[model samples]
Target: MRVTLPLLALGALLLSTGCSGAEEDAAPPPATPAQDGPAEHVFAPGEQITADLTMYDGDDGRRTPFFSGYRPTIEFRHGGLSGECGVRLPVELREFPPGETHTVVLECGTEVVVPADDRGFALVEDGVERGTGEVVLTGEG
Candidate 1:
């Protein structure tokens, strides 16, 4: 009876430790900005722009540069113009374990026209233009 009690206690302790929390519930550590690496900036004529830029882990171990293991892709719209017009600039990577700041050039088709007065944000894929925005550009240095 005593042996059974001890075993039960041990099992209970193990269970408590093992099942205390879930893997998904744990918060991920804050990620450092890849500011030191290369950056691509562009200006587009549509409300949305897509960028194809390469991100380096800068450390060993299997890691994804972007949040979702994909290239940097962002979409934004101006006031009340959510679905009117949009553009997509998909950035592609041509190399891995980059030796230095790699350049990804993008091509902005002539179909999407950019207004002189409207602000624009272009997606630069590897230092090239890939995607563009249609709104007034702001908040850039």
Candidate 2:
């Protein structure tokens, strides 16, 4: 199956929980080392992104076009530590035969970060969780 995931910076995990609040923009706090290194993660705000996805059908040697029409939905959630945050982009695909490959490109309009004390976002399809990814803040907040 064709699955595309976000390209996040090193040492950061993004998560989403169905919570909403003011779309506040703030400067990202200094990077905290998850392990001993230059910096564990970097968080910025108000950035743009473009991603290309390739989907392949496993059952058959044909590529599935289901993801081409998938709608991209965005959401945000809090992080475990204070000031940390995460964003989730959930793309919905039309039903297909069992074990069909589907791929598409997800264009994240803006780059945001996972708030502290919360996990990163999760990708859900038809109410079933498919994958997990991280979100980094970019640009001016």
Candidate 3:
């Protein structure tokens, strides 16, 4: 009788835990960013821009530089303007400067068109926005 009583209590406890209402009402975990992808950035037209290429990590446990053979190419686009630029990775192997900073130049029509106060420059890779840079129209285009 004692053993049967204890088993009944244990079963009740298990049933209660398995049917927890709190668990059903709990929120799900947030989504995580992609690990193997190029980061985005923005830049102004005709402005010299530099970006960290090592921030992107591939599934092979190596940075983007290793995959690109040290010559990583980034795509820049704003509105209807778009172009690809090749960047050289830093020769040094230090964490302080993990990757080389390549100057990105965005060109518009014949005259460089700076983004208005409401617009932004978009750095793209594989059709993804990795970074954005703001430009003040100083009439220097």
Candidate 4:
């Protein structure tokens, strides 16, 4: 009995000591890279955007005094007469969440990519943020 007890105790001690290193191996979930901290794109459903970006001068849309009237108006023309989607921003102004992109030609050759959140889109071009706009939710889809 004494021999069996010592053998069992040794076995238990060995087992416990062997598992002690396991705690170190059992680490938490791997963390994301620091550069990949912020999410690039987020899905937003049941919403639409109404952006008022600055574009070149035109007869149809209103003009802006900012940047010496070089940017754009609310509804400006691409070059002249014909209004086309021109502004090219990184973010896309969404019409509906996870749906098709916004299909509104503000001015000719003036494109506005919207950085949309749950509420609306941010009016930021590249890394420089010029402004932001709100969107109306249309559905829960």
Worst 10 residues of 2 by lDDT: 80-89
Off by over 4 Å in 2: 1-69, 72-76, 79-119
For each candidate, what is the lDDT?
Answer: 0.37, 0.35, 0.41, 0.34
Error of 4 at 78 (Å): 18
lDDT of 4 by residue, 1-141 (tens): 989999888888978877542457567999965552222222232222333333223342223222211232222122222112233232453222221233232222423333233333333333333333333323322
Candidate 2 Cα RMSD (Å): 26.4
Residue lDDT tens for model 1, 54-120: 3333342124332223343322222212222222223454333322223333233222333334433
Largest TM-score belongs to which candidate? 3
Across 1-141, the per-residue lDDT of candidate 3 in tens digits comes to 999999888888878878632457767998987553223334444344433332323432233333222222243234465555433333454232223333233333233333333334454555655444443333232
**Of 1 and 2, the candidate ranking higher by TM-score:** 2
Q: Report the poorest 10 consecutive residues by lDDT, candidate 1.
A: 78-87
- The 10-residue segment with the lowest total lDDT in model 4: 75-84
Residue 103's lDDT in candidate 2 = 32
Clashes of 3: 9
Candidate 4 residues lying further than 4 Å off, grouped into runs, are 13-35, 47-141
Error of 3 at 93 (Å): 11
Candidate 3 segments exceeding 4 Å error: 1-78, 86-111, 116-119, 136-141
Across 1-115, the per-residue lDDT of candidate 2 in tens digits comes to 1232332321123224423353547778999756332222333443332222222244332233333334424333443222122222235654433343233223344444444
